[model samples]
Target: MTRTPRGEAPDVGVPAHLAEHMTVAEQHDWIAGFLRRHPVSRRSALRRGSGVVAAMGLASAPWTLAACASAASAPVSVVGRHLSFGDDPLRSMAMAGELTAPPQGRVVVDLGQNGSFGATLPVEVRRLVSQVPQADGSIRASDQYFVHALATGLQPGQGYDYRFRLADGTTTDTATFHTAPRQPTSPWSFTAFADQGVDMVPPSGLSGFTNAYYKPDDTRRTMTPSTSMVDRIAATRPAFHLLAGDICYADPSGEGEPVKSTGTSKSPSGFDSFDPTVWTTYFGLIERSAASTPWMFATGNHDMEALYDDNTARGALHGYGGHAARLDLPRTGPSACPSVYSMRYGNVGVISVDANDLSMEIPTNAGYSGGSQVAWLRQTLLQWRAAGSGIDFVVAFFHHCAYATSSTHASDAGVRAAVAPLFDEFSVDLALQGHNHQYERSNPIRAGRSTTQVPDGGTARPETDGTTYVCVGSGGRPRYSWQPGEVDRYRGNPAPQGDVNVVSYQAVGASAKVPDAVDWSQARYLDYAYVTVDVVPPPGPGQVTTMTLRTITDTGVEIDRVTLERRAR
Candidate 1:
């Protein structure tokens, strides 16, 4: 019958002094009876004595007190910051810590939005280190990571992981990466893809181009669906990833839309408005792997014209601008135009040109014609030759295809006419393109014309003089069909029948010629595969180099292999 303060029920076992005064009817009553008996003046003293008694009870009730304390002192953990390579080698790493070290290395974090919380977090560089190559001939350990900012240092070819500390004494982990195969002779591989964009609605009731490009559906009869090919590419773990073009369909509206001619068209159809956030999300998904590795991007027709329209109030779309300008890319040498640049690794020289600028009639009319780019290309190649750089191979990349058979876009005759001679003059090994959404490969041809044209337009015949043309635009956009029976199967056409194609082009030196009677019977088109190139140095103190292309599935399965060897005359 004992009563608690302001309550009806008390502990089952009560002290005799309190029990004697308890009553069920008194539950809601004030403590008038107790005050009267105790005298109000002495109440404070009485409460102090009761507190001592309660302390004794708490000591006896260990389980209950321990449970209360446990609930009150629970520990919580949160991740607060991250970092990535910015406009230059020096970039601040993102971080958050209540008590300790944040994770380190090259850290790619989720930086929510401009007005979003945690956007203004302080990012500082704690330290810098230089990694020297080791004795094993492997420079893997040569990679350096910025301590506070969580970025990797520039190395010949290496990858490194780093650690970061927070103010609260906590720590976080991150990693920075670089190209592999430090020595030119060591063999390394990489994947190539093109024409990926964010498409929410596609024609024919399809989800969009991204899903179709990946070939995620099993209902289709494609030789290799999207999942299979993506898996294959991932398994290979190529040192780097090459994106041909059409990265994001960011038009003035910031969505994938057909380009309209300014002269006649007042309003273009199928032009959808896009949210800038969507672009980042789409790229985040498309480049999940490449973000961890070095990715090289070349422009495509869609990507170049997709940014903004001068006539529109939207002005210029900055969706892809932030990423493109901030990525950590290898030096393509000093040039007036950084967009059009060249980078040499080992004995191979890669020249990335702005083909979109070359093909756009309006830009050319405005006196752009990518003339500066062309001059840069010519000068860079000539400089390499003059210095006796001994580059074993030369590969050029742009958005538009010099040769294409897809119904979507015609082969840019203008671009071919302008750049073909340059390729021939420099003895360029391969020209990688991706404007067309399908895959196509051409035989070695010195000029725009094919070396040996087949009567049926099936494939190219064997030839010893020409630059190889490869159209691998099917990165993750919608797929388009080639005209039936219009396959170009020259001696070098990799896949003459399927949607995927793979071929290898060799650089044998300036004096060597393309060998006649090359083999192409085993070539097959891949729906969603990647091409890997392995560069090997010549034996016995020779300068000759060899490159092998392996078309692999997303699971890292080698579907086809072609070898190109440089033979000096």
Candidate 2:
């Protein structure tokens, strides 16, 4: 029984005629045929050792194949573990293990628990590979250990397989993963959501919280652990995760505490000082999904606490001041104010701004004045226009909103006054916000007013070269009810409370029946949902890009969808 370079178990069952120099595709086909002829049963002893090899007649006896195959099978137990992004491709893999080759690729043997344990693991191109370190502190060993290898510049849109070798001169395990599509036109889809905090607890004894408000009715809702929300979201297998804000309730020390509404006495330390353990729990539940895809975050009030020195800044008061500086975001703005940035993908430009920075005032009792963030926004928009960047679609996301109907959080009049004009000036197509905890959508509006007001249950305003606002804060956090008469559009009735509204939209632009609006709707209801934005490019030049927003429920159901088009200015 001859072994492969990676030292995997010898292919004893493989016929001698087909054993040499077969391509990967041919090897796969050969394996398929062999499996069909000899159906291996899980309960059969064949999997243990030579029992199956002896039946195949590949060796004089099971013992003969074991001596030759043990060396190869020894390494099969090691596999790839965690993979990440690194600045230098060569140096990146070095942290994991030694380099088989510097320029092209290298291999790291992680015999530690974090390394691959003879299981199938994925490897993607351009990703920094990691695995458990070797336990014996040596690369060579027959012991079951984990190993991770790193490779770079693999072609995109292609699938590749990797094999790990053991010190006993045998290959251990094999696994496969696909590279991301190279071009924008490649087929792909992603998921987006906001306000998924770690402290949210549903009502008890319920399969899922049905009350619109977050109040728990039974032990089930209360017992449904906050981390499970991450697991639920991961089951979707989305290409990416978009967190609107409040990822960790780092400020509040204990669980189930009302976020932010508590007085200064309850506030925690600075943001960095806040325990990362909360985030660890949150990530632990969803690492399976997050490891495969990128997570893009938009700052909410909770994230901004660290930046402020005032009483309101308590509870891990580290705002967006330098938040984005540490992240691997696709885009970042001026260094003076690093939190605000914009990145354009395909025809869409997603602008993430620090609304908290815009709210800061002088230390003394001084009058209100906008900060550098405001100036940066103006300059960024102007630069895009000056460059004649044909941005067909614009989506701006922040913590606060110009319009909100949630009773829990009143409309942030200050945010509306500060950012509304800038959005109008730039003709931003869509504005997404959280922090209100309720679900609300506004008519296409510019400046401080709506362009057109449709009647109740009527369709959204037509494309008019203006921006449409969406409040999607109900991402499994405590919900809040809307104040009476504060919102022009209100729709809550038969409120059994304890339920959070999950809103969805799509870009089809087709007419549909609208549900009865909720009046006195509290945004505090516990709910888990996401918004999907699909940009359908037009058939020809001078055509509009159709934008559809879909609100998906926890059960993979799309409850609501809205569509819009980019009107020619």
Candidate 3:
């Protein structure tokens, strides 16, 4: 519920003419007063037994009461607690949490060792942004505010427990997060996926992100496959998680267009509605793992929430205003590109790119960053690859596939235009991409062609074999089928779909259906899956350093694995 004031509800009837203008709180108050005035007895309801609801004519409203309930529920102490790395992961961390409204005053964090509490307590920044009206200038269901906190000068590689304390003396549950190590000394692993939109299930637990049951008998709802996939990811105890892009499909249209005025949780209008409440649902879904470990994110085409853009900061281009508020990603990259930044973990340097700025399939936000992003990417790559940098491997994760062979969204020519040369020049070990809604690993490519064949379980020598590309976008909104006569040929055996042709779309702007025969696709899987990459530094002197990449399905099945090996300098 939207933090109702400490007063009695208005004991007034809702006038027919004024009902349309009534706020959700007022509607709730009107219902309370109506119930107080006319009590219902143990009898059958009129007009399909709808009870007092139908009698009040609210049941006949074009919108959904389900929406009202979603916004009208009791206030939560805390939700959507997420962790991220600050300028320096080893010495700093950031947290972002959501509340229905500003706390009675402020939210304090009590941090300590992983299992303990109260090591350091301090009041943090509680920036309150009143829930704006809906995208179409309609009343919002609930008040949503975000709180960001930064912890610096902490011990490196140490796990800490923290919880929020509101001024009202109420405390939230505790979550533990581990800081990044000060240096690359040992082995670790991380998981990556993309295109995982907020999935709403029906009562029967069948079918997709759209809730089949628009109106349910109660508040109970089912879970989506992506939710279960989070648990599977958690089981791996990854050092961190990287969502390549298309994090949550708040704008189901995948286009940064104006939203429909009538869209709500009750009537999302099926893949066309622009419901911001999906963000609320998404944060709640990922809060568990995101709270525990750094959940780094990238922007996808659907993530272009133009609804939050303002003429001011972080919204001038890319329409990243919502991300700037909700996520605490590193901002040291190109200006105006919140999603483009680079950080190092252990011996691996990871970079997040704003592929939407270079995407051709959906070019609405393309070139939003001008040419500065390319410059920053080049500088970051050069810095990481410089001698004495101690970085043995570099991985770039983004939305558009620089080199993929899926039918729906094949390799993006724009991204290939910008980053392909840079990646090959810097010997980027892995280019983890997402747009294509399947799993595909390409042979190590140099100059836009395969330099070496690195099949599943094969060794990839990026120092010589060039950069290998993997498209693991099957994080679970829906599955995309393989292209016609384009089978996932492996070990000379093809999937039951069709021929073993290497044809795919080189997704450019208009007339983008162009397909070309490719010879780089090495492995492919059409299902809901993610990739776990293990980074093992050299065991000792004269030992070879390696990064093993594995593709695991949502059902915990490991389908493909490849080892990228490089001799330690």
TM-scores of the candidates are 0.57, 0.54, 0.79
Candidate 3 residues lying further than 4 Å off, grouped into runs, are 1-76, 118-142, 201-223, 252-271, 311-316, 489-501, 540-542
lDDT of 1 at 209: 36
Clashes of each: 58, 86, 1
- lDDT for each residue of candidate 1 in 1-569, tens digit (9 for 90 to 100): 21121111111112224422433222112222333343422223222111010111111111111111222233211221222222222222222111111223223222322223222233333211111111211111001112223333334454444333344344343434443334445666656867655444311111233433344542223333433444455555666567776665533222323222121112245422222222322433443354345566665544432112111221122112222322333335333333455666566667777664465211211123336667777887776655457566677877766665565453665566667888888777777787676655655666444554322123221224556676777564555654444453322345544322222222121122222222321233434445677767665244455676655433444545555556421
The global C-alpha lDDT for each of the candidates, from Candidate 1 onward, is: 0.41, 0.41, 0.66
For candidate 2, write residues 1-569 as lDDT tens digits: 21111111122122323433332224334544544554433223112222111111222212111222433332222211223222221122211111111112223332222233433323222211111011111110011111234445445444444454443444533333344433345323445666665543111100112234356542223333334445555565543456666554433332312112111222233111122122323443344455444456666545532211111211111233223222344335645433456765445666776554442111110011236667777887776655446556677787765655554444555566667888888777777887666556666666545566432233443335467777777666665554443322223323443322223211111122122232212222234456666666554456555667666545454545666676322
Which 10-residue window in model 2 sums to the lowest lDDT?
A: 132-141
**Reference-based lDDT, residue 67, model 3:** 22
Writing each residue's lDDT as its tens digit, candidate 3 over 1-569 gives 11111111111123323323333234344444544454433221111111011111212211121222322333435667888998788878887776643355667787888467755456544332212223333322222456777888888888888887777677678888888886657788999999887666221111226544223431112245577678787777789999998887754434222223332233244212344445656777787788888999988766664434442343334356667777788877877687888888878899999887886666656676778899999998888888878788899999988888776678888888999999988899999999788888888889888887766679988989999898989787565667666665433234453432476778765335566677788887776778899988876545799999988777677778899998765
In what order do the candidates fall by TM-score, top score first?
3, 1, 2
Off by over 4 Å in 1: 1-153, 162-173, 179-182, 198-231, 250-271, 286-288, 305-338, 360-370, 452-464, 487-526, 553-560, 567-569
- Report the Cα lDDT for candidate 2: 0.41
